[model samples]
Target: MNSLSPDSKEKTQKRVWEYPVPIVKGDNPEQVDAYLTGTIDEPSYYNELCHVLGTAEEGHSVTLHINTPGGIVDTALMVAEAIENSKASVTANIYGTVASAGTVIALACDDLVTSRHVSFMIHNYSGGMQGKGHEMKARQKYTDAHLSSVFNYYYGGFLTEEEMERVIEGSDIWIGAEEVAKRWQDKLKKAEGSDNG
Candidate 1:
């Protein structure tokens, strides 16, 4: 896994100072222009997301629209932590397909909205490594620990222990909008009921 840090040149890109609602006209919503296309990585993506989340005015909730196939685990985890710690309500909209790291981001949001056809894939994090016997075993252990930490972190409040185990053991967990909506609604209802009671 690569370490995520802001590059000197990354500072030059135009910062998004306001929360943007996805629009069909004008600029492409999917592309983070400041970071450039095909430059998807931990540092740049994480910094850009932080800029967007941080720039949101205090006491105002922000909606984040995501359409990604996922990227680095560390970056995703950092973004999730930011969302969790934010005082403002963070709502995430899955505009397209969210896989791996992207799914992790959605899980962090206070409310998750998904398009009719939007898809979410959740699977254990994986990466290729170039090394010899002992080194390979060490890398595998590192990856396992990283994945375990992430599972524990995100599912701590959102999912039961058994549910978390199911997610981890499943080969590929793909959830559509309707299923996600029902689950979210149920969770929200439970919270509301608890508050009222």
Candidate 2:
């Protein structure tokens, strides 16, 4: 029960990693999916995302489709904060590579929807320091606190306390949707069980 030419062969069988939610197309009068592609480290990028948030009406579901290689860390944090404070229930739909600060901004959404093919990365905060030994040490301490906060922002949803510390100290941890999905599963189960009980 196979359909293949005598000389043809399949290199690899395709597999589905995550279930796709069918976003209703055609005439969608009730919701809007705002597109946000390219790098997130630019001032213009942050302005645009905020513009969208500002223009949105209350109770509207705004989903941000992010496809970027990420940009500036501070910019990403600003965007994330905007999403977190938005009146609209924000959903981040990441279908492409969202690394660096992009991952930070995306995770700020109330709901995160990662495509099966998406890949993400998280690294500790990095910046230059030029001062005396003690001054540099103080800067390092501040950087450490900032790095820990960002790491928690991305992974705090489900990671245990011990695991969180380990991950926060990591240099550059590359991951995919599986990590997010696993965490989301735990949260969903807890919510459902609590509701039933």
Candidate 3:
């Protein structure tokens, strides 16, 4: 039933990998699929995504399925960077409850799609420190400044300046699917235009 000659170019087969599962490395750069489901708190989760995406070929199509309540800001940032740097074209299929640091990973993809009923949330980072009075105060200042930059880097355009300030002030913002689409329309258009060109 095969018509192609032996010298013909081989087509890459798409592979779907469900998250929270062990990563299976693929030999071909053109065939890579990675998924992210559940909390994004673990280093292993970061490693899994990178394992699949690291060798991706330019122009390869990759989709990352995301369903999570979010976790670990540092972990999410690392994952997002990997997604953004991949040579392949990556799309994030987000559904269920995406909250906290999960938004970072979802937004890093070259394209993003969300389910109709999906809920999105973002909030300020939280941490506690125990040390000498001066040390604790210094740590607090450093953490606040660092995390504020991270939030602005990812959510700057998607959220208004006022809303972003509130989030930095410890407010939790919840957004519906329609708003998500609306907020992201400009970015989507730009991506589309670039692809076409």
Candidate 4:
């Protein structure tokens, strides 16, 4: 469950830096800092985040600095679900390449910010197992259905169904910062305007 099929093997993270990032609110208030680097292979990542989110005060925020190439889809989804259910706000800063399940996890945040050179990618969730011919075929169908469910959950309004299909059916897509800004700014601006009005 922690690894994907060989077709989607990502290079191991050569390095990871974990540090506290303080965000000031109301003159001065402490905030939680969490980093999601490399792969999401273990359940601990999700558990620790759930603990942090649960302990943080309401209206307080936790910043999740995401710099991963993605990992176990189910594990990432667990963290994503925790974020969705948490009372504290979550901001996911995509600082590097956020791909596959990583992208889905990022979308669970209340706010998303992309670094100048960050790239985002969304494609099919791929997993495979060894079995007899019929078993393999059934597994493929199950994987496909599960992937579609994930896609819909994370990107229901991001693009048209047809466009989503094209990307899922085609090769991996690299979405640069400009495209992210274009797609996300309108929603942000709309919210800002409403707040001001």
Please provide, for model 2 over 1-197, each residue's C-alpha lDDT reduced to its tens digit, 9 standing for 90 to 100: 88766445332212111112112212554366655566665565457557666666678777878877776787877777778777788888887687777777776777788789887765655558799999999988887887787777566655556666666677566667877666656755655687799
Cα-based lDDT at residue 123, candidate 2:
60
Tens digits of lDDT, candidate 1, 1-197? 56545673344222332212121212433322211112125554456556656554556465667777777777777778777776667788776787778777777888887799988777776678887989999988878777888887664545556766777776566778887787677767767888899
Query: Per-model C-alpha lDDT, please?
Result: 0.65, 0.67, 0.77, 0.74
> For model 4, what is the C-alpha lDDT against the true structure?
0.74
Q: Report the Cα lDDT for residue 103, model 4.
A: 87
* Candidate No. with top TM-score: 3
| Models sorted by TM-score, best on top | 3, 4, 2, 1
Ranking by lDDT: 3, 4, 2, 1
What's the lDDT for residue 67 in model 3? Answer: 80
> Model 2 — which ten-residue stretch has the worst lDDT?
13-22
For model 3, what is the error of residue 45's alpha carbon versus the real structure, in angstroms, after optimal superposition? Answer: 2.9
TM-score of 4: 0.75
Model 4 poorest ten-residue lDDT run: 14-23
